[model samples]
Target chain A: MPAEPARRPTLDRVLRIDQATYDAIVEHARRDHPVEACGMVAGPLGSDRPVRLIEMVNAAGSPTFYEYDSTDLLRLYRELDDRDEEPVVIYHSHTATEAYPSVTDINLASEPGAHYVLVSTQEHGNNAGPVEFRSYRIIDGVVTEEEVTIAAAVDTNDAAEEHS
Target chain B: MAIEVRIPTILRTYTGGEKAVNADSAGAGTLSALIDSLEANHPGIKDRLIDGEDLRRFVNIYINDEDVRFIGSLEAALSDGDQVVILPAVAGGAR
Candidate 1:
């Protein structure tokens, strides 16, 4: 019998985001530098792809902390539910730290299925320099760093065709 | 009274994978009482929802789209068919 070919490994741990969303997230971080920007990218329920980016206001409005406005949070979730979508990526910025999950981030992580993307504006402070962009899966207080693949266009083959 | 409690994805394990569950609301119409009734049906869930008589700092609970904090925290009143949604605050920082 002929030898069977080895199966290719799936890139489940990698976050495959689109170029436009990526640029927008970086822009948001820069625009709100020193106050910590926050937002969510939502996609179809059960689909790992992040197709929509919704920038959120940092209710804390502080240099060291960021929180989505409570009213906005509820409205966002309701909107997602109405669209039959889920938060595929919950992203935030770190003004003075590296692109990594802080202790508070790990403790407050409630969405185990989301890709926690952290953008650090420390090096540039909204300037035209490189910023650290990283992704992680924080579940049950454990942080697992993941690969991030920024594609010119994310695959939308599995997306629903129509919305009511 | 039947109060619908919406559970966030991470806490669905305590609810046997139910997106929403029914909790008894026949007694005093307080959020605390609703949580206690929920804990009775789903063991080990109140701890995640409450801490030492207050809602956990990171946990956000809303009644009929109104934040519990504005309504009265644990003392927030409830009525039959009032939607109770619980979501952990999406928050963090550079520190």
Candidate 2:
């Protein structure tokens, strides 16, 4: 029998958010604007539900800048590994801004893979819907929009409850 | 209409009330020219996004977030539906 060829790896989608997640992220950004909001998007093994924000990290604003804490990022990555789920997408909110990357955001686009999603929010408002949820792939500082596969409700709440 | 170009928040005040603006052009398309046209219309956006040296080391432009620097700098091709997003070096965490 002939040996089979290895499958090519596909890039994970950043996911399109539903009303629930839209609410969760917007609320998170509103509660902590002027600063930045951070979180991880995860899914079950080989899931097609797209990437979902299973958890969030707040209090990112230090001296008027919302920075994704490296420690929090490490913790999230570790949790995803433990769950046997893949970390497909990484998202952040641009409070008082647009879906475009900022001067600071550009400098930090160092992660090799993983779709980067930006939720540009209203200058000020809690219930304000996101101005836009756009996706990007930044490799060596060049960015291009990739097709994001959005899953409806990939809930890890059950797992969270069980683990908690 | 030629093509509508949208400026990000940080670059908006430069455009003056015009978040999305139209660009008049020739077939000559280069990152440098596109920016010159934008600067002509918006006045100060190019300066903020670029410095005299190169695109500000901090600013990243996505011909949809793919990073123009790695692709072709300012020479990246432009399509009708293409959306360009610019973000600063927003790096941080909880403290």
Candidate 3:
């Protein structure tokens, strides 16, 4: 009998965000109506937790595309490096589309470890009834949708009590 | 020591599946020169990154997290311990 081929390694495919972080991302998306908004959340190196929310300007300023200002990106990276932090979450908003990674997004994802978050504000403008918010992992030119867990402290405590 | 160039997943085929490779830029310090050196070490890799003396429209090159396009494109300078990253342009979040 022939031996079975080795299985490919699986990529990390889950993202956890707190309520405040989630709300901030949505608000930034809504504020930049029509044009796309992009930003990053930094965390201590090797810690997957995203603690800092950074709002970035859409250099492209286009509805269909987004690009971080090269200068700003460089400065931000340098600062992160100095502080022993890394971009744990890189996010963007799609005004007229669902929250999903586009072909270009998968192509440009350089930080394989960071959670790529996408928010859609197509239905409502600031006054939200329904908005699409999702997270993904893009590694090796492949995109994998991941489960997003809202980590509210009160909710966690309540869930813990129920479990106990 | 040579500068390290990170090869994207789509371009790894040309590098024999190597994720990163080192290229000496002692004689030439510009990004263009480093790319030429990379091509010399790994044939057919330059074609994916360059077209008619210009980088492909969809390709993005970054050195130490700073985009080369904003600095000087192909003329961006290099130094020891510098890291280079190449990626394709992603667009269209629209429905």
Candidate 4:
């Protein structure tokens, strides 16, 4: 008998995001090229679907760094709490690199429950061209790349209906 | 003198998965005192929230609607019924 392959079963580690939201993220990244753009997509707690996209200002305003304005961060959490939602997706962009998490990104990833999305505009800055969009799970200093599915319609769990 | 401290998702483990916990004996005086009181109950959490004497640069703490950094940092005043929210900064970089 052949030795069993030392591999874990391929579970469905995918990010099912909507087309409009996806476009918005790309657009935001393009607009903030050279200066990183960051945002969040909030959804009902436990719902893996990213339904709402909220663009945030990069307080650092640096070409290679991004940080949500401190005041805005607080308000965003309050809004999420009011709607019984969570940051299902936390996204940012890279101006001159590929769509991948940098060392700083991995170290600063605090939301283990969120899908970390990275959009790279290095190919075409603020213009129409192929952009690299990717997603990952960064938890406890570990990075696991995941597949991103652009769904025309997202079907969140039952909890999503309560708010809608 | 109870101060309700809201724990972010990352720090929930120290809080036993609690979203919010009341620091009853936190001496309704200053933010630093409240943290000490919390440390007494939840071991190893203070280290995550505070680096040496100052708050970790990436960790954000808001007392009511005001950020602790603007108020007075560790010495920020606290009172009953003030909602203390602790949120790690949503930040990263390309380099």
Per-candidate Cα lDDT values, in order, are 0.89, 0.57, 0.77, 0.89
Candidate 1, clashing residue pairs? Answer: none
Model with the higher lDDT, candidate 2 or 3: 3
Model 1: lDDT equals 0.89
List the candidate numbers ranked by lDDT, top first: 1, 4, 3, 2
Write one digit per residue (lDDT tens) for candidate 3, span B1-95. Answer: 48998776568878898978999775778999999899998999899899998988767789988789878999898988999977654333553
State residue A83's C-alpha deviation in candidate 2, in Å: 1.5
**In CAPRI terms, where does candidate 2 land?**
incorrect
Each model's fraction of native contacts: 0.77, 0.19, 0.34, 0.90
TM-score of candidate 4 relative to the true fold: 0.93
TM-scores for all candidates: the values are 0.93, 0.47, 0.71, 0.93
Candidate 2: regions farther than 4 A off: A1-18, A45-54, A58-64, A147-164, B1-95
Q: Taking the tens digit of each residue's C-alpha lDDT, what string does model 1 give over B34-64?
A: 9999999999999998999799888899999
Q: What's the CA error at residue A73 for candidate 4, in Å?
A: 0.4
Which tens-of-lDDT digit does each residue in A52-72 have in candidate 4? Answer: 889999999998999999999
**Model 1 bad stretches (over 4 Å):** A1-12, A157-164
Please list the residue runs of candidate 3 whose C-alpha ends up more than 4 Å from where it truly belongs after superposition.
A1-12, A153-164, B1-23, B26-29, B39-52, B58-72, B75-92
Interface RMSD of each: 0.8, 10.7, 4.3, 0.6
lDDT of 1 by residue, A35-117 (tens): 89999999988778899999999999988888988899999999999988899999999999888788888888889999999
lDDT of 3 by residue, A23-60 (tens): 88988898897789899988776667787889988888
Question: For model 3, what is the error of residue B6's alpha carbon versus the real structure, in angstroms, after optimal superposition?
Answer: 8.8
* Residue range A23-113, candidate 2, lDDT tens digits: 6666766665655677656665455233467546554444224544334444454465577665455667776656655555554665545
What is candidate 2's local distance difference test score?
0.57
The candidates' DockQ values read: 0.82, 0.08, 0.24, 0.90
